[model samples]
Target: MALKFHIVNRIREQVKAQGDKTALRFQTAKGWGDISWRQFGQRIDDISRAMLVSGLAVQDKIAIFANNCPEWTITDMAALQIRCVPVPIYPTNTPDQTAYILKDAGARVLFVGDQTHADIAMSIAEQCPALEHIISFNENVDFAGHPMGMSWEAFMALGNDNVEQELQTRIADAAMDDLTTLIYTSGTTGEPKGVMLDYANFAAQLESHDKVLSISENEVSLAFLPLSHVFERCWTLFVLHNGATNCYLSNTNAVREALQEVQPTVMCAVPRFYEKIYSAVHEKVATANPVKKGMFHAAVTIGNKMATSIQQGKKPSALLQASYRMADKLVLSKLRQLLGGQIKMMPCGGAKLEPTIGRFFHAIGINVKLGYGMTETTATVSCWDSATFDADSIGLAMPGAQVKIGKNNEILVRGPMVMRGYFNKPKETAETFTEDGYLKTGDAGHIDAAGNLFITDRIKELMKTSGGKYIAPQVIEGKLGKDHFIEQIAVVADARHFVSALVVPCFETLEGWAKELNIKYHDRMDLIKHSDVVEMFEKRITELQKELAKFEQVKKFTLLPSEFSMTNGELTPTLKLRRKVILERYKKQIEAMYKKHM
Candidate 1:
């Protein structure tokens, strides 16, 4: 169905119907605070009026350089209400990257979260000639030396009776084709391009999600991921559209504590979140006594059986049902409590989630909805249905989204959710699509008999060894990365004769193991170089890769003291590996691994 109403009108309808009910929840100096629908509407209107007063015309680009916060969404909705395009800059982006986006998008106003963001904008404000106003979300942000800087409070107060008519006219003129947002892709290869998404794209998402997800006004979503990314940003809009409350989590490190405090019914997360949890749980389980360990394994086995039966549309036998109840009480229930015991659904994406991790979550009664998409697709091209369970596939294609294999097994998509094109890059945009108009996803995948999409690997990222063996690095990385001892792994096989990796150990678990083994070291580097530590990793890697082909196994590895990070240019904002950067950064270590063999 086509979008019948503009997003602003939908939000306005919710405000009138659900006034006094909480619409946004955010952290405060004391504790969690709530914003009623009435307040939310008022803030959005006020911000809209402020934009008009500040001389922002229709189609003007406004940038939000902030972490996940209530103000971030408020600003985004405000921009939509006034027909301005909201361009999000990842909070973790370097100054040069931020400046590039601001300049590329021609953003006139930049909204910053805190002093750090304000400083970044201030430093690059001159570099972006189009950037005029700097609005600070934090009241304490000192706009000391900047001429066009002001706190959010001051910015809101700029609106008055004068601009009310202009705001109303802008709202009344909102259209489905109106540009909603320009989300710059965190490119692993080259310069970032703005993906131009319109209101139609999001409206299709809202319509599609209605058919697949079971969510309502009663649901509470923990906004754990960065609001800058399309996955979290799109989910937040859907949550607010359903009159559900969204709890913003600015600091990602505090997610565990926030999950417990919020007790959210629904949340969106990446695969790494589950991977870490899976690894930690197993690490603990490995240290348990033999009796406890055996009992845990038995419970998981029963739970998996029950889950599989349900997925297959078969009623569990009475004996199986009874066994599942016992397992739930003995093991699964405790595991649920770790995630606050209220996660009805968790939409997992951004990368391939290992099948083992997917099955483990299902066994513990956590609904981890594995899905696929990209920034160009405005998030989900496909997602798991509540009753559908596929450990090896990324579920069925989303409603209204047509997915088919194109040349070289590339996944091609044609849907309302796909972006119009990359902003101001007509040549690149033309190259991104086929003659038949399908968006070239650049991902190699195939559809099974059940119509489920199974992703193989990124076509561009496939590595070819000197011996003429082609390898999918992600497949190898996903397998070995599940081991409790391995925190992160970057497979190194391109142009080399054998597979090798740079491994980062789970420091907390490794420390405990080292202590038990009476191993001593001075620092992280020293600890990673310890002979016992090397042997432990070698053994774990062997066990993890037992199912893999001989050519796919890691022949050798170098233990790293640190995990790849965004600040170091080793990872993108969405936690995708920047393989080129990683390869260049650790050139010496990668060379050492293949030195003897080559």
Candidate 2:
């Protein structure tokens, strides 16, 4: 299959061929609507034409700060067709993050999705020397010193110019190796680094994935992940090229509702999202009245036995198979119904998923596979097939992707999916690869005998205690996460006397467990402070401690009342717990937990 990585021209052709077919469905304040393939292609041609007429030149960069939407995509398509690099900044990123990315990438133009983002861009406009134009997706405000601007409706007017052939000529200038997009890394430390992904990089990642997964026109993707990130961007582009329909989620807050509405056969999500769903189900199961709880447990037992026995290649007796079928119809089928019963698979990434949860999901008829990659790699490295999954690994290195163990057990890879380099930073770019050019993944793990990639921990996430006991925090964290009560956890024990955990209880799940025990409380804080809740986690810690080495055992813990959210500084936009921030913000709690003499 020829990979149309540079997606614009194909968008034009897809329009002409499938003009009446629904190409994109997007949500708005009022409700949701869609555009036909021809109309979609026409919209792209117009956006490209508008940019051309608006004097957006070749090689120029445009910054788009928005949540996932139709216009967000059309802006990217317009930039690509004009051979300009489109740099997307995450909407969750603060004003400072927005300023740094815009200035660093030298974006000549800014596209703001709504008033909130427009205000942010305007605040930093004076600092950006290259930012000459501001385009607003909706008309709500006017800029003071903005040189040129237009609303989304008005911008489409400029695309009416006759530039089709001229656009094609510019498109021809696009070498498969030309930088098409600049995705800034969520610099957990200093400044965000711009990752320059080329057309070839884009093409290779998608085509390679298509070889492994069976996705095509009949497939539908219910997209909720941020498109500003490389994972969502690449996944959407791949879906389009495969002729798959995409239904943008209403909003991240309304994902469950959207899942029910769209019934998408495919979805892209982070591990945290999947973990939340798992916790929710477990909570619902645990809180049911005695009779219902008993029924649920019996169904789970039947399902697990059938799944395990079949997984081990055993043919169960007829009676057992009949019972499994009945349980599936009564219990598991209802669970699937909550998901709209169309979730064929959800490719999970951006964090490590718990192996136990993955196995349970598989048994429950959900394909929440653990795939692995990074933004710099255009998001493709390895992915797993639903039927042949390794609970502890990131499946096999994708087709056309080479995976090798490096000098210190680091995973090194070489593939067309790898980005060109850090834009305008040669030294940092040069340092990223080996002498032979394989990209160092910065993850420590080994490939199995069958070529599956098992990620033990992030090379950076590993911790060495004061006594020199090296513990892979993620391995332990993934284990602790298997328990439904402990929503999200960060194992913190760097240079400390012993290991400890900063536990964020799944409040919804924990609250019920408390109520069942007649544990009374005010809000989340009061609930967390309840002796029953503390006893629950203390008991859980004890149960989980038996599997760990002495030094690896979590000696003490503190459970937070709320989930770690992006708005708070405790989490990166990708939803990974920012350990440094967590450590600093809760220093008092950490010290208290360890009884440090200050």
Candidate 3:
């Protein structure tokens, strides 16, 4: 009920209910530490006062250019409480991208993660004319006498002389129509566009999310995904609304270590996280002794049957149920340990998750709820219910949201969670919706009789071959990228005679395989082109292609020495492939494949 108001209301409610309860936990060099709910609310109040002291006015834009840490959420809540619009920029963006967002949002104050972020902000200060103040979250950072920059310690001290009455008045004046945040899209194809969200959008999300997911006050959540993105940001708000403890991972590289330490009951992640976990599990099992490997496979087989039965709301056969218990003891339990042995529900979105991987995890009792949405929809459009889960689809539409398959099968959505419009892009915003009120999702999908939403591909990403057959590259890539040796893949089929691919192999595994076979190689480039290595991949691709139509199967593939990355303009901030960038970068390799066939 508290969620009906601004998200700050929920934080205050939690403080009143559990003043001394641990609300946030983060890993330190020595171990883990926590901050209580009362302390969290006090920080928000202090920060909100500081923001006002630093010249932040109601409806003013403030940017938080930081990673997933406690400060990011604190600053976001501070903005919400004071009715200021918080604009978040990805921590990985370059100076140019950073400046563009600041200038576009007309951000008056920028909160940086560290000295590096402050340096970037300083570098673009001239370009971002409206940016007035720079505050560093890390107190220990050396400012070197930057004119506009101040340490967080100095910034927070500015509020010490202030009373709480001013911040309280601002919170009391909070309205649903006030602009809450300006979330910029990752701009996989072009410059990022700011999506405007309001209090009503968030309230709708909380209502819809409540109908599908039930989180207890005792549950804990692991927060690793970038807080700038809507998927993580909105989910974090939900966690705070439910009064659950959230553990933050300072370094994403330490995800495996943190997972074991946190052992959270609920988590939100993208498909990539699950894919990596699946790959790691298989890579380890592949090296196990034959008896151990057999046991692992047997466990999966039994677990899959049990999972399937449970998903369909039927009891597993007595024999299968008995086998699952044994499997859980021998193999599944060990697998669960990698995720901290206590994950009850994990909601995955951002990209397509292969159903096979979904089955693999669910077979072992991990409920991986695959869902679908975009930044424009305030994150949640459709997600699975635990009792009526479907691996192949994103499940039924969330409550208060209406979904329909429109012209060309593009997923159309109409709901309160939909954004008001793109900031300062009237033409673009007008184009994004249909004559009817529904927002055009740009994703091609179909809903089955059971109301399960199965995504086919991005409408703009669909490619037509020279022979005039259309193909969904994502589906093909999803199928092939799940291979143990394939780390990443982008299928090339646009105007080409046959489908091809650019692959980045899992170099560590590939090297191990090479050493076992006595295949000598100097580097990745050499290993990728070796005849034996090519043949091994060819055999694997041939087997995988059996599931696809002839035109949809990749006819030729060239392995690259490097992986696609956000820094390299090949991937977006959310790790989604930038198809146009990838195609342009590998044009020569793609052209050669067609030339040889001709």
Candidate 4:
């Protein structure tokens, strides 16, 4: 496939060929509404022209502080079309975090998505002196007395006074090497660093992804993950690249409702999304009558057999084929309906998904393509092939990307998808790569002879026990997390006697268990502390740790009342545990687990 060097050029081509086709769809009070390719192109032109009229020049930094919405993409493409660099800040970030990013990037213009985002921008406007213009996508934002503030409509009006010729000139100046975006990593440790990615970086991602997965114009993709992150950003661009319609969900709380409403063909999500679905399916099955439960299990057995044959490139037995068709009608079809009944592919990234969960989704006919990548690599390095995939491994390195195990079993990647460098941090950027130029992924894992990547744990997160054993926390966590009663867990083993964990229970299921056992409690905190409840989790944890090595098992644990959330500084926006934050917050609880023996 011939790839366009500049992203806007691709959009322009799509506009010419598919002018009336839906390019973007968004929810409204009445119903879902769409913007055609021609309209999308026109909006980009208007936004680009507005940037030029506002005294912004080539390479000027512009920040987008917003959630996932149509306007976010419009602003991003518009800025890139004018040869200006776009800096995206997570909408969940507080004023301090948001200000730090804006000030560091030296953003000249800031676009706010709604009143909440507008307030954060305005609160920090004085801190970021370079931010001279504030444009709100929400018309209701009242910046009446503020000289620097204007609504998106008023901003577009300024574009009407300028000719489209100037915007075209800027687009023509765009180059593959030009800085396209500054994606700030939501660091699991330390301060967030800006990973500077050029046009070629994303271009390489587009090309490498095509080698493993094929998308067409007929595909409909749902955008629920934050686009500020590289994964969603790249995936959305690829959807647009193939002339597919991209649907935007205004609120993540409405994802299940939106999934059925839009019936998207493709989706990019984190492991939490899949885990929830898996949990819900199993929960429903567990409550069914004996015959229904038996039927469900029988259907899964047939589906698994069919999946294994298909993956290994062999035809299933005639009897098995007939059984699978019956299984689909009797059991599997209902499960597929939860995802809108049209999902063909779902690319899961950002965290480790239990192999069991991955296999369950695949057996049920949802191709959950689990992959691995970081912000430094433009969000994708490897993913399982649908035809021959292993649930235990992140599939072969993407085409044109080199992957090798480095010192300490670290996974290193060298490819066009690797980022240019961190913005304004030469020393840190230099340390991020090896002398041979492969970007140090900082993840400890090994590649199998068959070329599959299996990540064990973060190098920095490896725990050393007092007995001189090195424990991989993520390995233990992934195994323990499969139990329906457990929601989140962080293992603590560094310089300790044995492994212990801080676990957050799956409250809904725990409550159901409590009700069945007649365990009394007033609230989540009270429930977690009940002796019966604690004893039940203890038995469950002990049972789940059976597959682990003796040294790697979580011997003792503390059940917490709440899940680790981004707001609480326990998890990153992508839902990966912030190990350092978690350890520091629960130091006393972790220390107590080791004290009984002492």
Candidate 5:
């Protein structure tokens, strides 16, 4: 068991015992590297010792503005090991967003990942009074030219790097009750606020899942998920506590190749990854040989049948059993082989995955367990217990989590993993906390008889009509998103009246349709305005309307020329839609589309 002591102590203990075991790996531009626990721990020790010598005291906040790398976790462990708070800034965060978080958190030391991070931080260093020093995680990108700092290796040399006993003493100073990490959330309502979490939240979450999930010691996880995000952070703890080695993806673009080389036993990722894989397969099959396509289609059919039987708790029939074996051998098996066939399970989170996708993977013998949660919930609420998973539902609540629907159907969450209120915003914090102390998740959801939580909508996202009929736009929007052509959507229903949708078609999906129809376009803007593409969306909208209530149907719609972008302030860095911005930007266009005379 990891030291229920602060998160840092857990890493210390893991290193002490699992010295030779691989703790971290990185898919470099050159190739893959396997770093041992002892070396990983030594890097943490050197950083913490250097900081200590430099007068970084307990509770000091250190900010990391870097991409996914082995050094990110090394930095994380260094802070927690010393009972200090580490604030992780999103690697792709705008300079404006980066400034606000660093200044507000009063970060003392900053680890800038690359020139991109260094440039942004350097630009804003004048305004951030608390930032004392910057360390470069990259060697080639020297910081000697900068006014604030130096290279990472030089920073480490400032400490007594060989002080093993001093390292132990520093970790001993750590406490589970001490502040460990501060996650600043980019909330929908207002400015982002820091979420102060102690060792308890991380320990409670990692330990709870350990007992429930029992990942074996030698299991490997290919982690490309943003370490700044709680989903990956908690999963990293899961890997660390289980004695599993965590490999970092070189970049998002390197994910496919990394998967082939590493062939990790388990993967924790968002729904989009699976969606891309599914889409790529669909695209490939479109041009594959007739025999191969037929075989692939037949394999999917068998997998679907097997998935249904498993979900229903029945064994496959003799005919299906034989067919599945054949499919596995001929078609589906090669797909698994590409992933190294060690893919025992996939935990898909960050958004609701289509149940059909889950069923399809399960049918083909991959366990894609559907889980649900938010940043406020410390990122894990429910996960499909592989032992008793129901593909359609968002699994059962993780151990020790309480889910109760409140007065207006808001999902009230109470658990050890629940975050301390948003940093420095009591009024907002008070509003999110119930009188009885449950965290008001702002999500509309209900618990089933079997203890599964099915989220339906957001309380703040409902659209009401003149007659007082109200509808949750997210429900309809999510369903509409399932249509391959609909890439981005904003179901606008703010104070005005009835519902309408602002749709952005997946350019690839729409372009495929446009090609099939012998239509040509120069770009997304050109394609969106094309009568052929607009007509395609119109048909899709009409089809989905059949699934909606009369009052809830989207009466008028507009196909947007360009999708929402982070730079333009249309999406959260996590890539969630900012409805208010979308509503404001497209109001004029939407009004034109909605004119009764038009």
Candidate 6:
């Protein structure tokens, strides 16, 4: 199929075709508000002019340190319009981490979301000599009367008719190889690396998605994932390219409420989102009466049968079809309503999703497209097909992408969407690619005969016991994490005598169970340490790991009162576990688990 979209001039095209249509939607103090395509295009032009007036040259780096909001995308699209590279800093980044990226990228202008981000940028402004301006999206941000700081409105007012011609020229000069963005990878170890993505990279993503997914101007996409992440960033552009209304969600804690209000037809999310929903549903079912529990299971079974038949290209029997319709009306539809019933498709990635959870969503009417990609590959390289859904596989390689297994079973990819290189790191960039030109994904996986990709584990994360049994910790964690009581788990077995784990329980569920049993505790720490609580977790862990190999099962565990968080540096911005940090942080607890065995 011919490419229907390209990121370079997508906004202008959308504006000309549908000027009055809603291009953006955001939550306001009163309620929801909309921005038309005409307004969206005008804002981009104004920002582009402002950059030119500020003396920003082509490809000068502009940093955006913000949560998801309309201003974030406006700034990003604006920077692109003038051929400038927009570098995104995760909103949760620390002052030190923020300084590293600004200094490394040599950003000329910084855009911040709230007072917190503004203060962090201001604190590090002197450290980054290249930074000349800081614009705050939140007008209420306290700039302390800093000369270099200004509100977004004031910055936009700097644009004039004199710079209008220059802005137009820059937009017209857009090229395929122009550097589009510099996304810093949230590395689990060492400093983060800047991944350079170009117009060609995102163009390839638009084209590939056009072939695999069906999106139109009428579709409503909820932008909940951090736009700083590659998946959501690219998907947001695609949504605009299709002239769809893109809803901006600033606070992640309000996602449930936003979903109900927006009723988005499409959205991009991580596997954790789906896992949490799956766990919540199962948790409620676990406490229900026998009849309700039986009905829920029976409904899921019927839905699964119908889903399986369709996946295998067979029509369901008439009786089966009738049964599925009944199940959908009574049970499955209610499950979907939790996500806002209008969902047509949800693209899930960023971590391994348990196959059972993937199957569960598929059994319902909701279509979860579990794809695979990275900051190195402008978002998606593979995703589920509507005609042949395979919950266990990552579907086929995208239309213009090539995937193969290299030495160590690492998944290697070469495609238009693959990144150019790590910005300013020639040696590291050279090390990332094979001589034949495939980007080494550093993930171990295999391709089935039918061209489906199945990821086993991150090669670097694989753990081996002292007895030499290799264990994929993610597989074990994915299984146990499905239990509603377990919130987070990190398997510890590398060069150790036996497998062990540090688990953080779902406190709400655990506390409710404790109350039901009439157990008393002083606090979360006391609750977790209580004999009854410990015994219950022990029993649940044993049952959850029954399918795992004997050597891979978690033999000993330490329960933590708190969930791993970005603030504590235990997790990366994308929420991937920083195992080294986790290991060091809980050294005492980890050592306790192996002290007797040692």
User: Model 3 segments beyond 4 Å from truth?
Assistant: 1-5, 161-163
Q: Which ten contiguous residues of candidate 6 have the minimum total lDDT?
A: 1-10
Q: Could you tell me the lDDT of residue 542 within candidate 1?
A: 92
Error of 3 at 424 (Å): 0.7
lDDT of 5 by residue, 1-598 (tens): 2456346666767899899988998966678888899999888878888888777877899999988889898888887776678999988788888889998899989998888788888889888899999888988775547878778889888888455566677676666667778898876557788987777777778777876676877999988788888888788878887778999874778777788888998989887676666656666777689999999999999887887777778988999999989999988887776666789887888877766567667766788878888777778888887756766678888888988889888888898888877777778888888888899887787878888788777788777765688787866775676666667778876554677788887777777778878887787788888887777678878896676787777877888877788778888766777878877888797787557523
| Residues 1-598, model 3: lDDT tens digits | 2445467777788888988888999878789999999999988888898887776788999999987788889889998898999999999998989998999999999999977888899889989888888999888777688888898778888885464677888988888888999999986788899999999899889777877898877889999899999999998899988899988886899988898888999999998888888888898899899999999999999988887788788978889878889999998998999899999999999988988898898988898888899999999899877777678888889988899999999999998999999999999999999898899999999999988898999999999998999999989988988888989999998888899999899998899999999999888899998999999999998997788998899988998999999888899999989999998988898888878999
Would you list the clashing residue pairs of candidate 1? none
Better of 1 and 3 by TM-score: 1
Local distance difference test, per candidate?
0.92, 0.81, 0.89, 0.89, 0.79, 0.92
Task: Provide the RMSD of all predictions against the true structure, rounded to 1 decimal.
Answer: 1.0, 2.4, 1.3, 1.4, 2.5, 1.2
The C-alpha TM-scores of every prediction are 0.99, 0.94, 0.98, 0.98, 0.93, 0.99
What's the count of clashing pairs in each model shown? 0, 0, 0, 0, 0, 0
For candidate 2, the lDDT comes to: 0.81
Per-residue lDDT tens digits of candidate 6, residues 226-345?
999998999999999888999999999999999999999999999889989999999999999999999899999998898889889998999999999999999999999999999999
Candidate 2 lDDT tens digits, 35-103: 777777777778888888777788889999988888888888888989888999998888988999989
Question: What are the per-residue Cα lDDT tens digits for candidate 4 across 327-430?
Answer: 99999999899999999999999877889899999889999999999999999988898888789998878988899999999999999989999999999999
TM-score, structure 4 vs. true? 0.98
Candidate 4 runs further than 4 Å off: 1-3, 161-163
Q: RMSD to the native, candidate 3?
A: 1.3
Alpha-carbon lDDT of model 4: 0.89
Positional deviation of 101 in candidate 2, in angstroms? Answer: 0.6
